[model samples]
Target: MGEENLAAVLHAAEDLRLEKWPLPEPKENEVLVRMARVGICGSDVHFLKHGRIGDFVVKKPMVIGHESSGVVVRCGKAVTSLKPGDKVALEPGVPCRHCSYCKEGIYNVCPKVSFFACPPTSGTMARYFCHPEDFCFKLPDNVSLEEGALLEPLAVGVHSCRRGGVGLGSKVLVIGAGPIGLVTLLTAKAMGAATVILTDVVEQRLEVAKKIGADGTLLTGKLNEEEIVKQIWNLFGGDGPDVALDCSGTEPGQRLAFLAPKPRGVAVMVGVGPPEIKAPLLSACLREVDIKTIFRYCNDYPAALAMLASGKVNVKQLITHNYKLEEALQAFQTARSGVGNPIKIMVHCSQ
Candidate 1:
């Protein structure tokens, strides 16, 4: 409860430091949280290594994590939803309610949103932080603090599955076995997809996918677009999948997702990729395949929490490594090198 608390700041590219800083106070509608765990997302690593992610450049020193959970230590006067000792997951983005996007129920795309770890917003890679009480969803007793932190990414998976229209007897193909990809696979399976095929370049990741209940795993190493298409078709018995999701964001992965769907099937691009991508659009146009894109997530936290609380999704298997706040540099290094079979690396802020 002291004023000084530890925080991980990205001072410069590949230069992360853990230092003592003043704990922030909550505003009238905010709550002060004692951070429990913070998940190291790919965006975090990108910012640590390059000091920027696309247009959001770190012109000033910024805290490093967004997918996180914490215990509420203090609540503002107007905060009636949460109180002290409540364990909750921070949604990370706060959008202006007056905006058209917010009014239209798509706050994730709000232009006036202030998201954690993005440009000017300081993130939750610290001992204590403050956020809007509404953005903090209380976790049930069955869900651990670590699982609370994972809800952020799991929300994305839920959104992707919803967009892809996954349901009973749905045959789903998930490209990429990274954190988001694995989460998507789990979400699709939980939504009643009979078959889920996961593809990744790393054998270890694919192995993890299988362990996590993926019906099949494919290793696509330097395979051309045609070869990848053939492999996917063969996996689905030469009929193509009911739904294909591109969670890798690579050109090849996106192309494969677009081409792996049967006529009238859906292809959802859930991965983050370059602005301009080259693909075979004519094939998709002729097949009448529907294309959809996801941006973060919307109205998915409640579903993610319900799934976790009900044991419908096993997210614990995705956490492969853990480190203290002081070991942030090593965590970033390990994530960047990809030398080990790391799936989701967590930074323990409370430790």
Candidate 2:
């Protein structure tokens, strides 16, 4: 028999199965990689629980993971920068360079892009996969495959901060202490935010946020919207944060993120949320508070990989659970149950 690949296939909502699939070969400009680690992203969980994210539906069985890192097993004839035995992080989305967005260097939203685990396109939750060589970035010696996988989300933090203009002496307010929020806090500080206040409904997540880099933690459970606004200003000495980043995506959270920013301050919506949202947009506009949104990330992986390698960002501490790829269903269950106070669940595939 020819070589086969083991994949974690999601057939329907909460219906994931382990199956032997065909191993892929590299194209002239592609490289075949043996996936070593895949981090479970929020969108992965959303797709499994709902079978779709807006218009992207899973009409066919698909392997379901995008945040991944692997070792190069083989390289195509045209791929010279990467060779056998190179460890690299896969940039899940491949854009057509001919598109206008790609030409503008904003290919993350290129309409024709094929993003892994997003539907029709298969993903890297398998023993082996083939991807374009240019999209697979080599990892530094100090970075682990797991850390390499995290660059995907860190890129989001980087993109969001860049859009919000987070920099030197900035006072930032981050809503939601989930993985994304924590990452934003770290990125803000790394970019020189002098003070950061983080809010979350979960105490444990707040604790983890503190351990990472948050200057202040606010448990948002008991506070009303106005109270949250009051408390946030009070935390920063009765002044609003210079920039507010909303990572919660909840209605109240989004509204509060915009409200917490100083007049003329910048606020961003980074997390994916319900299709429709109601917030104080008119009020924000009158105050000249700039409200922006973050799609996926683009052109930030190189910096993110550098940050991970130089110890500027420590994603290792964010991982709370680890399981072999064979136990992927169990890992998904743990993530969905919200039990074990799991911050991040990782699936090791190479073993």
Candidate 3:
């Protein structure tokens, strides 16, 4: 490999450029990886278009990818878990080990966590980047690099289902048929949920969801909130689902998360929506629905990997587009434009 490390750099809103980034060196606890597959996330498109996601604003140039898989190129002296030539999926966030939250094993909320592609921190979109050894999960022989790249989003699904207490025979409702929602549906089914219903405004996405394993799908574009809720309730035989996972993060989706769950059931917010919204909080409170939220993920990577390796969850069909590292701008444009209704756009970072 050469020292010329090319990357898709985001300068500001609508300002993405291909440039040669500095080749990073691994610290004792880190390993250098030659990136193979990088998936473009919705957050990547959001940051490129708006230069911000809530309070985290892109004030300077930064590499712009997070969902990625790579081959280990070099390992630092003290890195014992991984070795050169190993294929691994990169978990973007690395939290401070000393944080109280990290001590409690919920490092996703560590205040000083440095997550890839989140404003100031550089991401794994480049040809080569360094990541902490502990944060990278080695891929099994059965998992392709593409599937490994997808594990990042799959981890979110695993975490969301776990938070929602999806288990054997648990009925689950997922709001939105986006990437996250689809993965959540897959996870819930793999976790032995008896019924998993997904809702989305896009019929195409719902079609995809049905193909993947959603027991039922509702197209909610033409329906009002109340009607949609009633229809969702009907799906579970005149009763709300055991758990409602909101992956749309829209006001309607969040409200449904609260309203469409059985009494004393769980509602987990998996999407990043607007900072504030008018929700049916009192109604949910009165019904005793337990509201919860997931930041990124905590200790869920192994489950995601196991599911993929065991053929329990298939994410291959969700990848609708592919581009080379040089065509990253076009990839981002295609993703943003929704040309062909692409579910996942994968970028090959290695030449």
Candidate 4:
């Protein structure tokens, strides 16, 4: 209702400030949403702490948040799917429809895509934000705004599972136990994975994974590469898993997952880590193991929403802390510390 809305802007590395910004208006195909909850992502922390993630650099001040949900306050004349007072989850990435990637239905790989909180595109860490009407999926009455905000990350999990070819009775090993890892575990289980083994160096995170229905949790800190492989074999009852999803991008995690799967098994890399690592390619090549890597996600929002609405995936448990927009810096600090079981930290824009 006012010209200015509160926004958390990252002016420089590790220097985030809450400021007043003019509320954005909806375009012909867009809708204006009053942001309710914005989840702090690992990428957000990476950009804040290091100022850059690979090629994308924070050259200018940008609002920092992508996983978000909000209430539609205004709709453009041409917007038909959503209306004022509708609660929805914003997909955050707007791909160019003219590109071949978009035409092929894999718009997440569109080179010209504009994603929120990414280098040049401002994010939804503000009270009032405008997004394309088609990108905002209306939330069901049963889903809360908090659950809606988590749909962004859950979409990634769904996408990763789909890419990994997970299905009924599939045996899955998820490496990482972080937010994405836990979500992937949940997705696999919901997809009918008979056994889901989660591995993480953090005991607390592994404990959380066990609480979330991981058939087994492995502490990777005490095991070396070969021992880790042995443990996974044991978890699979002497037979390696059918699918191994590496949600932890660390070299060790990748190595373990690569060696822990059965011959001709599928190995999916879902986490962001170093560009290159000394992997055991010979072993993988000898076994005909299929190695696949997932980009952000493609066309997964609807499935994520459906899963949440059906109660197949309970993401609310992932949230461990909440902060007002003004306390974004502190929130980032807490996330970076990783002291307490901080699975997800949310920032309330209206607070």
Candidate 2 has what TM-score? 0.98
Q: What lDDT tens digits, residue by residue, belong to model 4 across residues 288-313?
A: 89999999988999999999999999
In model 2, pairs of residues that clash are none
Per-residue error (Å), model 2, residue 84: 0.6
Better of 1 and 3 by lDDT: 3
Predicted candidate 1 versus true structure: per-residue lDDT over 40-73, tens digit per residue: 9999999988999888999888888999999999
Every model's TM-score: 0.98, 0.98, 0.98, 0.98
TM-score of candidate 4 on Cα atoms, chains taken together: 0.98
- Kindly give the number of clashing pairs for every candidate: 0, 0, 0, 0
Task: Count clashing pairs, candidate 4.
Answer: 0
Clashing pairs in 3: none
State the lDDT of candidate 2 residue by residue for 174-276, as single tens digits: 9999989988998999888999889999899999988998999999899888998989999999889989999998888888977888889998999887888
Selected candidate, larger lDDT, 2 vs 4: 4
Q: Residue 286 deviation, candidate 3, in Å?
A: 2.6
Which ten residues in a row are the worst by lDDT in model 4? 2-11
lDDT of 3: 0.94
- Candidate lDDT scores, in order, read 0.91, 0.90, 0.94, 0.91
**Pairs with steric clashes in candidate 1:** none
Q: After superposing candidate 1, which stretches have Cα over 4 Å from the reference?
A: none
